[model samples]
Target chain A: MTEIKFWRGFFSILLVISLLFFIFHVWAVILPFAFGIIIAYLVNPLVDNLAAMGLKRSRVVLILYLILLGAGIMLAMTLIPSLIKEANAAVKELPAYTTAIDDLITKANGEIQKFIKPIFKSKSDVIAIPFAAQKFIDSLIPQLPQKILGVAHAGLWIIIIPFVSFFALSHGKSWIDIIFDSTPSEYVENLLGFMAELNATLGGYVRGLIIESLCVGLLTIAGLWAMGIKGAVLLGVITGLVNFVPFMAPLLGGGLALLTAYFQFKSFSVLVGIALLFIGVRLFDDFVLIPFVVGSSVHLHPVIMVFAILAGVEVAGFIGLVFAIPVAVVIKVFLSVALRHRKERLMFRHEHVYS
Target chain B: MNLSFYRLIKKLFNDENHGEEMSFLRGVPIFFGLSSHQLGRIMQAIQKRKYYAGEILFQEGQIGKAVFIIKTGRVELVKNVPEGGEPRLLGNLGPGQIFGEMALLEHRPRTASARVVEDGEIFLLYTATLEALLKNHPAIGVKLMRNIAVMLSALLRRTNQELENQKKS
Candidate 1:
């Protein structure tokens, strides 16, 4: 009886998760909502920190939102004209990349055809990437209408997010109180302490990840541009964005770039430099970035982290991967604060023990 | 507005859902992606209570009627294990967690005893009340059940992990 109930419960959960994943990924209207969630996560720590300093969280959030608005406008004012000129120049250079693409594809098609198909099905799988690179260039310049639609879509969310975040952050204090108010009088302090720890761990980890990824992307873009790499802007964006996927970004990004560099320069040294560049970025991220950001967030065993990621992936797909660590941290925090045996923190100054 | 703000803001931030601001339970993994209306319903059905230190929440052999949400302070589970192993202090629970859930879910006699370790608060959701709430507001129930499943799955996973770690050691 128990076994049947258990399996039944498990499958139902799996089903709901899959449904939600489909909803988020497939629904265009849901994108704005997803953006809101991302913005909320990004700004929550800022709101919390501000609130700790005696300002009302909502007003602080409002102030920050205004600053973000100003900064975004300022960035566009400075960056847009230059970006447009370069983008136009890049468009003029598109046919050249297309010719390059066709040449590279033709050169590789023979060697690739020999072994790739039996192992991997499509010829397009290996070839389409470089072609897509050309297509991305073509589409960007030619698809003004699509770009306009995208801007409108993204802009709607951009406008809505601050208002939503403001409300959420400002009134967050009240929200927490309601949660406490719902509590049976006896376990309030215990629950509050547990919640505090959970908040810190989850919030800290997420904020750290955002900062690290942005830092990596910004630095890589600057570095690649300095190195005179073609399409440095695009490559940097791709690398930085993909940087979120721990232990996987370098191989994917580097391998692609290595092929590009190998063909472009047709020499060993450029390839070596490119390879070293990727290795350097990976080393920096793994050794310096992740250690600083993700290390102190949670103390889960590696297996647990892997399981949590898998579970999150199963539940929400790609978006879930981003949220998985924080969720896992929350669960861990729950165990320690809400479920662990009482141990006084040495930091508690003079109070011997609350109990 | 200022009067209301002063009265409310003067109080410690407790309920994240009512009065001052909506509870940020929306950020909680359990309540993710739920609409404000949906999240609000769950918050509304809930009720809070307080308990002093050393109170016995429930005991073995007693039929559990309510699930307790630890708002603050600690609740320890004193369990009787007699396989030549020492009796277990299952845990000391702190804020924002729900316990007595298993008992509430199954009409089982309390398998272990729960006692508050300090002056604490809990939100008691009687099964009968929650059922009615579930009937009237099904989304909240669905979300709540999902959240509980997550908690259970986590507990099960941790137990599995501990067993695996023990084996490895």
Candidate 2:
């Protein structure tokens, strides 16, 4: 028994480690599937509502798919030339950013040496830091090949996911029925309860999210436009997409935008305006929109939200960040159902008296 | 003679031919002790609504924004469940049964789907009204919870008895 217990414990840990590693390993390939699920979840309520109104779920899914595809095509048609132009422009200007960065680093190093060498009385120490940093960056660049491969895998996955989701949504009812019928009666009820709760949580989340993302995107565009930045739409899309990752997204997007603004405008005032815009966008999200929209429905604390994000990032890099909360919500749904049933059992009554 | 007098009042209140609706509050235990004036206040707040046969009374897992009381006709509780299998019937509910009481304290999602078996009239009580009622009559919340506890416990006991009988058979 002792030996079996040891082995069981060891295997459990191993199983967890393997599962985590596999999730990370296949994340690039799995990202599109996860994205597809999120998309289906976002679109499901609309589709279901429409379906309830005499339209077929399949037809609804088809219509939504078309809208998404048409929108993507339109975006590509509208933005590709400008995007290409920007790409070329960025490539052309890449050297300038690099040069500016290098100059900045060199100037900072010069100041450090001036201040530190005499105080430390060590001539070589001040020179050592830059050389080490530069060497580290050079070493890291070679590892980009795997990351590039991951991006390619992600692209392939994205292309196939929508078609898969359409099929999932259309045939979902029968598939759902089959799943429910296969379970034992009691378990079926539990599972049914779970699905119902899952639907509610995901529905609330997706509805809240789509509205929030659009708000963030539009606000970001307005802010950037007011700040006199070029490519406001593009920056807005980046902001919206990044906002999906919680707190880090807006900052990252804003910082990237700021870098471009600094380079393109070369105006300190423009830089300040850009910074203020990001802060304003974040504040809007934190205060007015979040309270009214997402509100207290999910009831996850900010600290728990942060921890979930970190864990998600650790296990699946970026995709985990997107999925962890809903996944937690599902577990919560299960626990809640189990507890409700348990509560009933605990409060067992021989007689049901009426008021 | 005294029993007959109590019966007369009960018949008068319970009779549909008297041209008055069964005030929904009387069916719910917590509201029994309320003065007629207080019950009248609750009745004024209610939205009397009707549903036809096959019409959804309420969907399972929907956010319970209102409390529903079934005054007449039967309701079948179903769950539109899709796991990965065929969906199963959760249970059935009937007249005088309260469907949305589980979510009285908060907007807990409806656990079971309900649809009218025949044309049915129900009194829809909003959560806001309940909140106000709780404020005005502080004991109502506790009484309401106790009523729910009793209902839930009764369901468990009946199920238990059924299982034991099945085993014996």
Please list, in the order the candidates appear, how each scores on TM-score for chain B only. Answer: 0.76, 0.70
What is the C-alpha local distance difference test score of each model?
0.65, 0.66
Worst 10 residues of 1 chain A by lDDT: A346-355
Question: Per-residue lDDT for A163 in model 2?
Answer: 67
Question: A1-355 in candidate 1: lDDT tens per residue?
Answer: 9999999999999999999888857766665555666577667655654453334555567678789889989988865665676567666766776777677776777667666667777743564324445666666777788769877877787777766766666665567677766666444534543454455456556677777877777776676676666656666666766666555457656765665565556789887887778788878887998897655646667788788889878876665675566568667776775443243322222322111
Instruction: DockQ for candidate 1, please give it.
Output: 0.03
Residue-level lDDT of model 2, residues A1-355, one tens digit each, is: 9999999999999999999899779866666776766677666655654543334456567778899899988978977776577667776786677677677777787787777787788654646345443455567789889888887876787677886677777776557656744554324333444455455445666577668877998898778877777767678877886676667556778887888898888899998888888888889888977787765366566787778778877877766776666566656666765686566544533222111
Which DockQ values do the candidates obtain, in the order shown? Answer: 0.03, 0.03
CA lDDT of B100 in candidate 1? 79
Summing lDDT over every window of 10 consecutive residues in candidate 1 chain B, give the lowest-scoring window.
B13-22
Residue A132 displacement (Å), model 1: 9.5
Model 1, global lDDT:
0.65
